[model samples]
Structures are given as C-alpha cells and as structure tokens.
Target chain A: MNSTFANVVARRDLLRELTLADLRSQSQVSRLGWLWWVVDPLVMMLIYWVVVAGIFGRGERYAPYPVFILCAMLPWKHFTSSLNAASGVLRASESLIKSIAFPTMALPITQVLARFWHHLFGLLVLFATSWIAGLPLGLALVQLPLLLVFQLVLVLGLSLLVACFGALIRDLKGFLGHVMRVGFYLSPTLYGIDLVREQSANLGGWMADWLPRLFLLNPFAVLIGGYRDVFFFNRMVEPEMWALLTVQSFGALWLGYRVYLHFDRRVIKFL
Target chain B: MSDAPKIAREKNAPVIEARGLGIWFNLQSRRRVSIKSILLGSGLRSDQKVLWALRDVNFEVADGSVLGVIGPNGAGKSTLCLALSGILTPDEGDVAVRGKVSTLLSLGAGFNRDLSGRDNILVNGAYLGMRRDEIQSRMEEIVAFSELGDFIDQPVRFYSSGMRARLSFSIASSLEPEILILDEVLSVGDQAFQRKSRERMQQMMARSRAIVLVSHAMPFLRELCTHCLWLERGHVRGFGEAQEMLDAYEAELAPE
Candidate 1:
C-alpha cells in the first residue's frame, strides 16, 4: 500500500509535465493557435444565441440569454470535450502505452487537465462578459472552487470509464458522439430549469413533476445548474442539490476507477 | 517457484526474473463479429482466434550483467522487452524487477512531434522517471550529447530519424536508471554517433546498472553482452553465455 501511494505520487509528477506538453501540442496544430479555444466556444455561443433567440424567439424570454447559456455552456463544453479527448487517449498514445511502463491512468488524466485548462480560459472570457452585462460579482463566486472540484472528480471518472471501454470497442467513439449530442438537448444548457418545470406542469401529472427532478439527476445538468446557481443566480445551492452533486461525483469516480483498474492490464492487448 | 516463500530469497537475486511468461493476441477475423450481434444470439464462433506472441518463456538477469535478447523478425523480441519493462503483463507468469527501469523500446515513441526538441526532452525525461528540476538541469547536457545543437529548439517533426534516435537515447541514458532496457536502438545515427553511444553504454555497465539489450546485431551482442537468450517462434531456443548463443544462433541460420 505504501509503495502504491509512492508510485501514484511519482505518477503525478509525470502527469503534470505531460499535461503541459499535451496542452501545448494541442494549440500548436493550427496557425490560429490557442485562439481557437476561445473562438470555438464564442462561435458555439453565437450559434446557440441565433438559433434560440432568432428562430425560436426565446432569447428575449431569458433577456440575458448569452450569460445564461455561457454559465451552463462553458462547463458543458469542458465536460464533453474532456471526455471525448480522454476516451481516446490510450489509443492515441499507442506507442507510449505499448512501450513505456508509466501509470496508464495518466493518459486520460492529462486530457482532463488540459481540457480544464482550456475551460478556465473560457471561464475568464465569460466572467468579463458577465461584468460587461452588469452582473454583480458576489460572494457566490467563491463557490466556483468547490463546484469545479465536484466537476473534475466527475469528469475524471467518466473519462476513465469511457477510455477503458473505448480501448476494447472500436465503435465507442461513434456511440459516444451520439450520446453526447442527445445529452446536449437533454441538459439545461439552453433552456432554464424553471422553463422546463413550467412547461412540464402544463402537461399535468406526476410524469411532469418527475421531469424536472429527472433533469437534475443528469449529472451534467446538475453541474450546469450549480454553475448557474452560483455565478448567475447568486443563490446558495439547495441542500438536496448538494447531496445529488456529491453523490454523482463520488459515484462516477468510484465506478470509473474500478473499471479502469479492472482493464488496466488487459487494455494494452486490445489496443 | 509457485509456492516460493514471499520473503527470505536474497541469495544473489537477479535484478529481473521472468518465469513461465506468456502472452497471446487475438487475431481479428476477416469480418469482425460484433458483440451486439453475438449477444443477440448469432451462432458465430465466439472463441477468438489466438496468436501466442510468447509462451512459457523464462529468463533471469543479474546486476552488472548485460543480457541480450536476439531473434529474427516476428520472433517476439520486442514483446520480451516490453514484458520485462512491465508494459505488457504476462498471461501465465510474472516478471519481478528489483529497481527503477528505463526503456528505449523505440525511437521517439512518446515524443510529440509538434513540440520542440527541448520540450520533448522535458516530457520524455519526466516519463523516464526524472523530476522536472532534474530534467531542466540536465537539459543542456542532453542537447550537447545528442549533438543536435540549435535544432533542439525546433519542433521534432523537422528532425531526421537519426536525430530523433540520438535525442531519445540521450534523454534515456541521462536518467541513470537502475535497469536499462534497449530494443535495437543502439544502431542509431552515423557510425560516429554509434561508437559514441556504444562507449556511453559501456560506461553504464561499468556503473553496475543491470542492462537488457535486445538486438539482431550479433557482433554487437558478442562485444558487450555477458549473457544472451535466443528466442524463435515465441519459444526459447538458447539461453547461456553471449558468445555461445551467438555461435549457436548463427549456425542454426546456416543453409542445409
């Protein structure tokens, strides 16, 4: 047990350096460079704004729709992209995985860290925009660190789980892409939770009542809700919401870690 | 050895010990039978077509000794190197290494070509078990050793194959690993660079690091190796002193 702990510490050192390298290499691919990280999300927000505000005419309903979406969109983007990249990291690091003896977990972890780095930059842009829009900076911003910790644990777990199964199944990438696409609509990134609750109430039944609660059960929705609650609403997260977030984060982590460990030895062969 | 005691076996224990090591690969059939299809109750053969890359292979390497692994193409030489380094777990047996191991299994295996040579050095160094400060301190020395000069600042994709080999070897050797595993990477760069690397490897041996060198170069093996193991078709054909195994391997290759 002591040796395992020491090994994990050593692995952390390597992970830190490799994560920096991974991030650098990501931006090096294009002449536009790291600007793409900022621009890509801006473009995404623009599309979301045009579609919901222009076509659906829902933008005025939310008033400050961009900030509303940005709160959830930024975290959603981080979660999805990190998982997408991490899921293929083992296969992507084929030579390293086949030749080196370092902890395999580092590959997926570096992806999460790199994506999180990009997400933090994106968050900076969002905070500036929020200030421009006259959204007051409150003590609620302090909740960010705790929210991020929860999100990171959840992301790390999901990434490892997907990556392990991804190594064995050639079609996992395609399947994941579809799942994430459906998840985009299912998540509360574009629509407000109150909007869903109000609409579901018009349907008039327990199913309608369960719909909002069920949306909260989607961990990403809960995470987006947390970000929205802290940064936008300036409200303390509900106690039940806290319990749900903690449970989702730790539960995903436990499952992911266990799945990764089970497949660690077998993954190389499949790859 | 199955029931061997957990402790109290330190009578000149080998730095690396592999017993009954085996590994197999599944050969994907011409048409991949999807798991979904199988679960739906198709009658396709669920038993995978297996290719045994290594089977029941066993060996030992002691401290201060150079053990050479020699085999032809597809003879599991590279797999043996990987297995010893703990990259590939054995299916039937186990390999125990007493100390830190650094492997040069392929030229620039972990390098990000988009990154400059200096960054690759930092990454590869960290991966090979060196700390960040240690890599930074050794940076210039590694560059000087690789003889890449100003090219060290350029992205590695611009580097020639020989340059990549030199950089990787220089980074790996600088780590001063207790167990060094090389896989046909010593024949790197020009004859001058080869000679220089050969001298460096000899110096490593002089420092008493247990070395496992996998190569097809017989003369090189005879020159440096204290012991050798010959493998063919995933089976050990010979294991003994370096010169004897080289002689036997060469004679076995002679035409009838």
Candidate 2:
C-alpha cells in the first residue's frame, strides 16, 4: 500500500497527462469539438425534460422540474458514464497494457478523471440553467465542492472495482450497461426522494419503510440527494448524511483498492 | 549524459537474478456453457488449460553487462523481459532486480495518437518512472534524437510508423535506467536514424549498469551482448557467452 501510494505520487504528472489525453482523443474526431462533451448531457437533459415535463405533464408536479432533474441527472450522468467507461477501459487499453508497465490503477483513475472533466463542463451548464430557472444561488454553492470531492471518491472506487472485474468477466462489459440502467431507476435521477417517501407512506407497511431505506443505502441516491440539497435547496448537508456519504465513499475506495491490489498482477494475463 | 562513477564489475553481485522463474497463462476453454447445461449439472467442471509462456528460467546478470535474449516467435523472450522488469509476475519462483528498471517492449504503445509527439514523450517518459520536470529537461534531447523536428508538435497520428518508433525508443533511452529491458524496439527509423539509435544505445549502455535486450537480429545481439540466452518453446536452449550461443543456435537452425 505504501508502495502503491508512492507509485501514484511518483507518476502524478503522467496520470494528469493520460487523463488530458483521454479527453483530447475523445473530442478530437468530432466536428462539434469540445462542445460535444457538454452538449451530450445537455441533450440528454432536454430529452428527459420533453418526456417527463412536456408529454407526461410532470412539469407541474414539481415547480421547475427541469432544475430538479438537472441537479440529479448531471451527477448521475457523471457516475454512469464514468463507470461505463472505466469498466471497459482495461480491455480498451489492450495495446497500452501490453506495452507499458505502469500502475493498473492509473487506467481507471484516468477514466474517472476524463469523465470528471466532461462532467465539470456539464455542471457549469447545469448551474447556468438552474440560475435561469430562478433556483437561488447562494452559500450552498460552497457545499458543491465538498459534494464533488465525495462523489469523486465514490466514482473512483467503483470505477476501479468495475474495471478490475470487467477484465476477468468478459460478459460484464455488456452486462454493466444493464446494471447501470437498473441503477438509474433505483437511484433518484428522474424522480424525487420525497416522492418515494410519500408513496411509501401511502402503502403503509414495514416493506414500504424499507423501500426508502433501500434507496438511501445506495451511494448514488445519497450523493444525488446531497447535490440537490446544495444546488436547489441551498442548504448544508445534514451531519448524519455527511457522515454516511463519507463512510460510503471511503469504504468503496478501500474495497476497490484491495480488489485492485489482488488483481493488478493478474490483469495482464486477462488482458 | 550525467557523469556518475559507474559501479565496478564485481563477481557474484548480480543486478538481476531469476531463480526458477516461470509464468503461465490460463487459456479459457472455448466450449460455451448455457443455462440449460448448468441446470443439468453438465459442463460445470473447469476446462481451463495452462499455457506455460516461460518455464524454469534462471539467470543472473551482473552490472556492466548486457544479457541478450534470442528466440523465435512464441519463445517467451518478451515474457522474460517483462518479468525481469517487474511488469509481469512469475507464476512460480521469483525474479529480483536491484535497480530502477525501464522497458521499451513495443512501439507506439500507450501513445494517444491525437496528441503531439512532444506530449507523448512526457506521457511515455512519466510511464518509465521519470518525473515531469525530468522529462521536460530531456525534451530537447528526445526531440533531437527522434529527429521529428516540425512533426514533434503535430499529432502523432500523422507521423510514419518509423517516426513513432523513434519517439518511443528515444524517450526510454533518455531515462538511462540502471536496469534497461528493451524488447525488439531497436529496429526503428531509417537507416541513418537506425545508426544514430545504435550510437544512442551504445551511449545509454555506457551509463546503464545492466541491460537486457530481446531481438531477433542475432548479429546485433552478438555485437552488443556479453552473454546470451536462446529460448525455444519457453525453454532455454542455450545460455553462455554470446559467440558460443549464437554459433550453436545458428547451427541448430541450419539446413538438415
């Protein structure tokens, strides 16, 4: 573990360069250029807005549903895209893995950072759209950075785990998309957490109470909830939520690191 | 090109030592298993076969010497190079190296083609364990060695394959690692550039305490190496002085 940290610290610049290179390689071929990075999420947001607000008449259910969805959707997009990219990144970097012998963790970390770059751009668009929608921008925005740090840790850990397992399980490359799809519905991406609580109250059972707890157990729900609290509500994350989010992120990271360490040497053979 | 007192040749002080080093790959059985077969409790037994890429390899290379590995395709030359450099762990036994190791196993690897040749240098150099400032300081030398000139700033995708090869080789050579493992990357660039690379390698070898080269070009190995190992089907066919091993390997491959 000490050696692993030393290796990462030693190649910090290389990691940065690899992350930048990922972004450049992705955006280089497109005619829209770097705009595509932000445009992708923007388009997805518009599609959701059209379906949920325009067709389903969900616009009236929540005042400015676009803002509500954007806050959660953008972060969810970051998480899903990062995981998706990270999972297959090892197989995608078949040539690089065969050629160079750097830390394997660097590959997943690079994926996380690359998606984070695009997510950061998408986030700027989100903030602008939120401001236009009359969502108050205030001291709560300061909590945005804290939330980002926690989310980054969560994403990095999951990415490592997925990347490692995805290397071993050939079916996982395709299956992960399905997993993320299920995760999207399970998470509070398009809907409100309060909606779940309200529905659960109407059901009136132990099972109903457990359903909301199940949602909270998901790190994505906790993070999306935290992001909404800061971006829309302009409030500090509750102390208990903060503790839970911290524990979840770091716990995932520790587990991911252990898994990576177990599989790092074996990854080459799998690749 | 930094002048430091070279370690004098000392008997029994090996820079790299491999004791019964072996590496194997588990080839996944191609027989598809369906849910029906699993439910019937058939095809549940493991069908994985182990392909030993390298087996029972043992060698000790001292400072101020080059160990040239010569082998035909699938002879585990690259596997040995990778294990020696700490890239691939051996499935059995162990390999120990006493100094910083750098490998240039394949060309244009880990390079983002969209990035300029100069940027690739920084990334590759960092991969080889040099710090950013260290890579930056050697940028001019790497560029000069690669001779890409104006193409250095252009995206590497446009460069010729030889040009890409030159860039990768130059970066690894510039690092001047104590234990350098180069796997068949020396045959790069044009004839004139190849000559320059050879000269550059000679200079790098002068500085590096130990070097391992895996190449199909036997004469190149004969000229550069003090000792050689010839591999065939993951087994060492010959290991001795360069001239003796080369002659024996050549004899073995001769007609009839």
Candidate 3:
C-alpha cells in the first residue's frame, strides 16, 4: 500500500514534465502564438453572435447573448475537447506508452489539463466582456473556480474512460463523434433548461424522471448551469444544485477511474 | 556465496534482480475462427507457438557494477533488456528493480518523431522522471553532448539512426541514475562518438552507479564489466568474473 502511494506520488513529477511538453508542442506553431487560445473562441463567439443573435436581433431579449453563450460555450468546449483529445492521448503517445513506467493517468490528466488551461484564455475574455458589456459582476464569480473543480473531476474520470477504451478500439472515436453530434442538440448549451422543461418535459418519456436526473448528471450540465447562474442569474448557486453536482462529480470520477486502472497495463499493448 | 546476504543488505542493492524470468508470446491467432464457424465444421488448428523469447533466466548484479549481457542472434538479449526495464512483465518468476532507473532499450523508444529535437529531449527526460527545471539545467549539456549542431531545432525523424542514438544516450546519461540499462546503443554511433560514449559511461560508473550493458561486442564487454552474464537460448550459459564468463560463452558458440 505504501509503495503504491509512493508510485502514485512519483507520477506527479512526471506529470509536470508531460504538461510542459504538451504546452510547448501546443505553442510551437505561433504566428499569433498563445493569443490564438483567446482568439479562436473569441472568433467563434462573434460568429455565433452574428448569425444567431445579430441576424435575428435576439440580442434585445437575451441582452448580452455573447456573454450567455460564452458562459455556456466555455465549459462545453472544455468538456468536449478534453474528451476528444483524451480519446487519442494514449494512442498518440504510443512510443512513451510502450517504453516507460509512466502512470497511465498521466495521459488523460494532461489532456484534461491542457484543454482546461486553453479554456482559461476564453474565460478571461468572458469575464472582461461581462464587465465591459455591463453584465455586472457578483460574489459568485469568486466561486466559479471552486465550481470548476467538480467539473474537472467529472471530466478527468470521463477522459480516463475514453482514453482506455479508445486505445483498445480504434473505431470508438467515430462512435464518440456521432454521440457528441447528437448530444449538441440535446444539451442545454444553445437552449435554456427552463425552455426544455416547458416544451419537452416528456421528451424523456418512459425514463422521464430518471433520464433528466441522469442527463443533469452529465457534468457539463451542472457546469454550464452553474456558469449561467454566476453570470446571468447573478445569484448564488442553490444548495441542492451544488450538492447534486458533487454527487454527480464523484460518481463520474469513480466510474472513470476504475475503468482506467483496470485496462491500464494492457493499453500500450493494444495501441 | 558467503557474501550473498551481505550483498543483499548493502546500499543500492543490485538495482535489478530477476530469478527464473521467462516470457511466452501468446499471440492470438491471426485468422479468428469464430465459435459458430467452428461448430459449422470449419476446421482450424488453434494452438501455435513461434518463439520462446526468454526462459527460466536467473542473474544478479552488484551496485555500481556494469554487467555486459552478450548473446548470439535470437538469444533473447532484447527480451531480457525489456524484462529488466519493466517494459515487459514475465510469465514465470519475478523481476524487481530498486530505486529509479533509466532504460535505453533502443534509440527512439520514448521519442516523439514529429516534435523537434529539443522537444523530444524534454519528453525523454520526463520519461526518466526529470522535472522541467531539471531538464532545463541539463539541456545545454545534453545538446552539446549530442553535437547535432544546427540540427537540434529540426525534428528527430530527420536525423539518422546514429544521431537519434546519440541524443537518446546523451539525455539518458545526463541524469545520474542508480540503475542504467543500455541495449546495443553504443554501437549505433560513429567510432568517435562510441569512444566518447564509453568515456562518459566510465565517468558515470566512477560515481558508483550500476549499469547493465547489453551488446554483442565482446571487446566492449571485456573493457567495462566487472561481471559478464552470458545468455544462451534465454538461459545463463555462465555468470562470473568478466573474462571466464566471456571465454566460456565464446567456446560454446565456437564449434561443435
């Protein structure tokens, strides 16, 4: 037991190195350099605002639709990209995987961390836009990092699952891409949760109560919802919401971690 | 024989120990005969065995000692290297490594081919458990040692096998390890670099770090190792003081 703990701790040092290499590889192609992190999403926010908000003049009602979408989009982007990159992290680093005694989770953690750090650039833009556009800051903004912790735990677990499974089955990437495509419409990123509840409360049908409960447990749901509360609602997160998010986070983490550890030794061979 | 227990209790105990180590390749059949197909009278022979890579190998090395693992072709030297490096788990017996180790099994095992030379160094250093600053501190030393000149900025794939081997060796030896496992890497470089590598290794050994060198070069084996393990057909042909083991191993291969 003590040896296992020591091995796990020894992995952190390697994780620091992997993270730096990851960032360096990411930043090597820079005409605009690290600015691209903020710019890529800023460009997307503008494009969405133009087509969806400007053309339809929905900005009048949504007020800062950019801010709304930014909040919703930021975490969604983080979650999906983390999942997408993680799906290939082990396969991509096949050489390192085969040669070293690196902790298997290092791959997923770096994927999640890189995506999370990249999303921070977009986040700085969000906070600045919220202030400049007069969305009004609240004490809740201070708590967003704490809320993001739950989201990260949930994503970390999901990344582990995706990385291990994806290493074994090459076709899983396609299956996941299709699932994310369907999920985009189903998730509350573009539409409001109240809108879904009002119109499609029975959309879940047989699993009505059970499915939304599971769907809300999707990590990004709580994540984007919490984000919305901070920026849009300007109110503190409800105690029940925070509690449910914690449970959901732990469940994702536990399931993801177990799956990862089970297949770790064989992942490199499969790759 | 009298010193076995004393040796076991010493500081930096034989960095690697393997007793009865063996690896069997259980590759699933290429053409999978489904259960339905088999039941429908599609006859197939399911049992197949091609190679016994390593079989019932036992050996020991002392701290700060270099053990040259020399073998004939297909004698399981690489498999032994993998087992010692913890890359491949054995099916029988056990292998235990004390403290940290750096394994240079092959030139580019941990290298990222797409990344620049500098980036591969960082990745490789991390594989050896060096932090960013640690790698940073040793970066100039590694680059200078490789002597790739202006090509250090280029991708690793652009370099010849020799250059890749040099960089790998340089990064590996840069970090002082309690255990260093080398697999035929010294022979990859040009003659000048080979001499340089041997010198660097000698300096490393002077600090009392154990090195397990695997090669077919008997001269190299005679030059460095206090002990030589002669592996034949995945089992020990002889193990003792360098010259006696090497002579016995050569006589076994000399003639019928």
TM-score of chain B of each: 0.85, 0.84, 0.79
lDDT of 1 by residue, B174-244 (tens): 86778888888467789999999988877776665688988877787888899999999898988999989
Tens digits of lDDT, candidate 2, A119-228: 88988888888888898888888888888999999988888899887776666766778888998998988888888999998898795789898888899889989888
The number of the candidate with the highest DockQ is 1
* RMSD (CA, Å), each prediction: 3.3, 3.9, 5.3
lDDT of 2 by residue, B1-256 (tens): 1111123435666887777889997765233333445457763667568789999988878778899998789999988877776777778877778777777777778888888888788788766667778888999998998888899999988988988888888887787678788888466789998898888877877888998988878778888899998898888887889899998888888898
Each prediction's TM-score versus the true structure = 0.92, 0.91, 0.82
Give the Å shift of residue B120 in candidate 3: 5.4
The CAPRI quality class of candidate 2 comes to acceptable
Model 1 residue runs over 4 Å out of place are A1-6, B1-9, B29-46
Tens-digit lDDT string for candidate 1 (A1-271): 0112246566677889888998888889888888987887777878888999988998987767777888888888888898888777887888877777777787788889899888888888778767877877698888889899998999988998988877776667777888999999998888888888998899888968898998888998888888888767878888788899999999998898888887786778777
lDDT of each prediction vs. the true structure? 0.81, 0.81, 0.74
Candidate 1 vs candidate 2: which has greater DockQ? Answer: 1
Q: Candidate 1 or 3, higher TM-score? A: 1
- List model 3 lDDT by residue over A46-78, tens digit each: 887997787977665566888878887787788
Predicted model with the maximum TM-score: 1
Whole-model lDDT, model 2: 0.81
User: Chain A TM-score per candidate?
Assistant: 0.94, 0.95, 0.90
